[model samples]
Target: MDDDGLFTIGALARRTGLTVKTIRFYSDTGIVPSTDRSPAGYRLYDINALARLDLVRTLRDLGLELAVIRQVLDREISVPEVAAAHADALEVQIRTLRLRRAVLRAVAKRGSTPREMNLMHKLAKLSDEERRRLVSDFIDDAFGGLEANPEFVAMMRSAMPDLPDDPEPEQVDAWVELAELTQDPDFRAAVRRMAEYQASERAQGDTTGLHHDLTEAVRDRVGHALASGIAPDAAEAVPIVNDLTARYARTFNRTDDEDLRDWLLTRLEIANDPRAERYWHLLAVINAWPAPPSLAPVFAWLTEALRAGTSSRPTTV
Candidate 1:
């Protein structure tokens, strides 16, 4: 019994550091077998039972269920194999906790009423396939007729939001915001305007400029005005609009045409929505898409200027 193998059940528990009651449970469940009995019928164990018991104790502590523990003990699975499977299980658990955290965060941020909370939870729990269908529906609405245009289709589809299988906190936050955006009336209106604008561009037989100079110039001029804290209604607003219109014409490889300029300006106005800008931001996070510059603010600035008489004129290229 000193250094050899067989020992009494009590001795085996002491050797493996398991409680006597638990050791008895394992024996009763046939997990560890008693080697035999003395003349007095006292239970005894073989030396190998001590090692097996030690493994069982460790596995139990690591959260292996009783059935899996039995598997390991029976040589139906290796210890490492069990550990790996349980590790994956823990990852799934961690994801669940993370999602819960994000839900709580959104609720706190929105001061959600009961109905809102239920809606939030429903959107947050959308499965990958469901989320895909949602985005696909958006794209279909945006590009159904224009899918024949490879470039347009590519850009629109690339804008699709895809939440990862195991998303980070940011991605989760993005998804929540994106879901909110999709259900928002204002956002839908803005995106509808955008979709219609793109369709019009396709009908116009290629609104794309070989050079992005117009978009860049407009972005720069508007950016400068914003930096200067120029109010959209100031006298300066007109020049800014004219400049942007000219830039737009140049970008399309043409001279400034008043009718086209008016149409483009109106399109920008219609598509301008702060919430729409937010949609792109959240979409970037969920899909890990590249960051794009904000154009909505520029349109916002222009809108205010057009609506007022005090703003600076928009710069023309």
Candidate 2:
């Protein structure tokens, strides 16, 4: 300290733990202007200048630009305001970094080709609203102007892929697959056919909504039959098939006869597309929802059993 209670640039460097060149640069920029000069014209700083240099260094460490830090030092903006703005910016950066990490991890896990990696990165980087729009477009294409079951359509619209900021690699993979599935022409045509079938049924005065109970009944009965190692064509499946057909008969106001069995088989064949099951599975994974039981196996069992017991060939819609 000089007799004037000021510190030379070298003294300020030692006190503030900053290199002499850095302190001299700040002094030259007038960010922490030299308060005085010694007899030999050395840059001298007082207590306030030392305080300003410390604040500048701290802000710089926090990724603040020199321009913003200068405004903070000049009192053009308050520190809290700058901090809040920077924090919001940092949040966007953090989300972007997390997404990148997820894409890279997914690429590594999948051993993806360059083309696949590029697609994954593009799809994963979509904004939340953009992601929702992609699904919404698919639903519209599949069900637009068709009297599809309202409940099922509602469920489809509601269960959109919501990739989180810090997504797991599985979630990333699911999202990428989902995006591709929604865009697949064959898958889209199949879903549209399902919608048309539903619309046709609706037009025929079949005003039934989604038959959750009927579905659960099939899954339960067929799941039990599957667990017992009973083949769909085995005699043991006859009673199980009869029970499920009776349930469906009551649910859809039809008689439990050969006709009902044939109709039920047609419905199962239409709904049992493996891609359809995969669509839901991916949605469950991306949204962190409990995986719905694999209805594919259950539906397959019932379809084969119906075919075994009834004189009906698989109908293509």
Candidate 3:
């Protein structure tokens, strides 16, 4: 090559596409040491320094730290090992960014205020422990004071709203809404009341309480009442009210009576909140359980009937 059998620093820089300052810096740092110098004291390199500089540039681009790159260039570790470790780190970073992006989307969709957005960001940024705690609180509120039906308790605890580490768009949306619903005090109270009924009769071993599954009957009949705008106490509501009353009476191993109808109506009124129905539906999704029957229209009909008319009233006393 040259008279001294080495390329000049400028020549090495051109081959490496590196600035003279950078190549000089690497030389000073001992990463790509010059083989020898010309009599003019200019730095000199054969092919080896050029190759070392290329490896340095590649490793830097792959996010390797200077120390790591040094070890790599010194042959202290294999490239595959470094690449694998960096890949795992990148995976975690990518997942975190994806979750943050989803959080932004949810915020935009809801048009969340500043504080709400902050809270949302906090929730989305939760560690596994924090996320588990949120759901556990909801479960605790729903099941507190309830009889420890082993199956029920197990299902509640194990029924995590487990958004996958790499959650889909819909799952992220579900999780955000779920978090909001559970945070409502009214929703918490409603679920608590529902749990009270389950724990009480079931604990007392009243197997026949929901025996008739008046769910379908209520949904079908009361849904019609709601759709027709029949008030809960309207004469038009008589047939539907009587239907649920008759169904409830049958569960008690007793014949129907005016007093029985009144009692059933009272209980239904206590148990039939719209939000409670929604809470249960959401819980089904979070727990991946089969959906229980809906009762909103059942309550809606009862509410309207109570308000409308009483021509065929089932006497309360």
Candidate 4:
């Protein structure tokens, strides 16, 4: 140690493992002022100066700005206070990076065109409340003025697609598709039609029992008939069709007659809509919900069978 208990710039660099130029820059900036100067005119630093330099280097390593570090060295803020602020800043940066990565991955997977990429980027960055509002508006536009029961509206609201804070690429892609789907005129029309159908049924006191029973009969009996390769018009499919029609009739409190079969066929036609199912599937993807197995195939099979059976049945003279 020199008589003044100070170390030269070179000595401080060796102790801190920082280059001499760096320490000189810090000293020049008055962040680590030297305690004295040697006779040879070399900058000299005491223990306090060394401690400040060490803190500055540590903060720089953690990505703090020089001005913030200066605040710490000048006691304008405590070290912990500056550290807490930087930590919050880093958290925001990390969230931004995560969203960027999700968008990039979605773009790569889709091989998205420039326009599509731009749309996906916007959709991916929407705040949670913004996303929810977007979907809610779509739902309101589709189902409003229709007599869709309150329970149905509540169910749709509860199933709103919410992108997670750190969404995966698939979730981002789903969000993009869902945003586009919700805005599509044709898709909105389809959902509106479905909502109108539901309203009409509910007005007649048709609770969920009709749909529940039909789904059960189609999935259980008709699904087996389809897998067994029974043609819709085949004599062997008669019992399966009869069984399903009977179950559906009982559920709707109607007899298994031609008019009832025709009404059932119309209901089945609407229930077999693929676009409606796609909406739910996309919603599940964005919200990270488990996708329910599609019932469209079963409903479609039943529709074909009902058409063939109802057409072939002898009409009373």
On TM-score, the candidate that comes out on top is 2
Residues 235-316, model 2: lDDT tens digits: 8887787777777777776652447766888888887799999999999999999998888888888888887873232221
Quote the positional error of residue 142 for candidate 2 in Å.
0.9
- lDDT for predicted candidate 2 compared with the true structure: 0.89
> 114-211, model 1: which lDDT tens digit per residue?
88767667776787778867877765765466523456456656676676655665676678777766766666656766666766666766546233
For model 2, the superposed segments whose C-alpha errors exceed 4 Å read 256-259, 309-317
- For model 3, residues 91-185, the per-residue Cα lDDT tens digits are 88988998888778877877879987787677766777777799899888788767734465576687667655665544566666778888888
What lDDT score is found at residue 59 in candidate 4? 95
User: Number of clashes in model 1?
Assistant: 29
Better of 1 and 4 by TM-score: 4
Per lDDT, what order, best first?
2, 4, 3, 1
Please list all clashing residue pairs in model 3, or write none if there are none.
Answer: 231-304, 231-305, 232-304, 232-305, 232-306, 233-305, 233-306, 233-309, 234-309
Error of 2 at 156 (Å): 1.3
Best by lDDT: 2
Better of 3 and 4 by TM-score: 4
Per-residue lDDT of candidate 4, residues 1-317 (tens digit): 57788999888999999999999999999899989887888888999998888999999999999988888888899988987888899988887789889999989988999998888888888888999999999999988987775676787889888887788999999888888888999888887887888899889877662355567767888678778998777888777777777776777766635587788789777756787788889988988889978888777777887888633322221
Q: Each candidate's TM vs. the true structure?
A: 0.79, 0.92, 0.78, 0.86
Off by over 4 Å in 1: 1-5, 105-130, 147-153, 159-171, 207-211, 252-261, 285-293, 307-317
lDDT of 2 at 66: 97
Q: What is the Å distance of residue 219 in model 1 from its true position?
A: 2.1
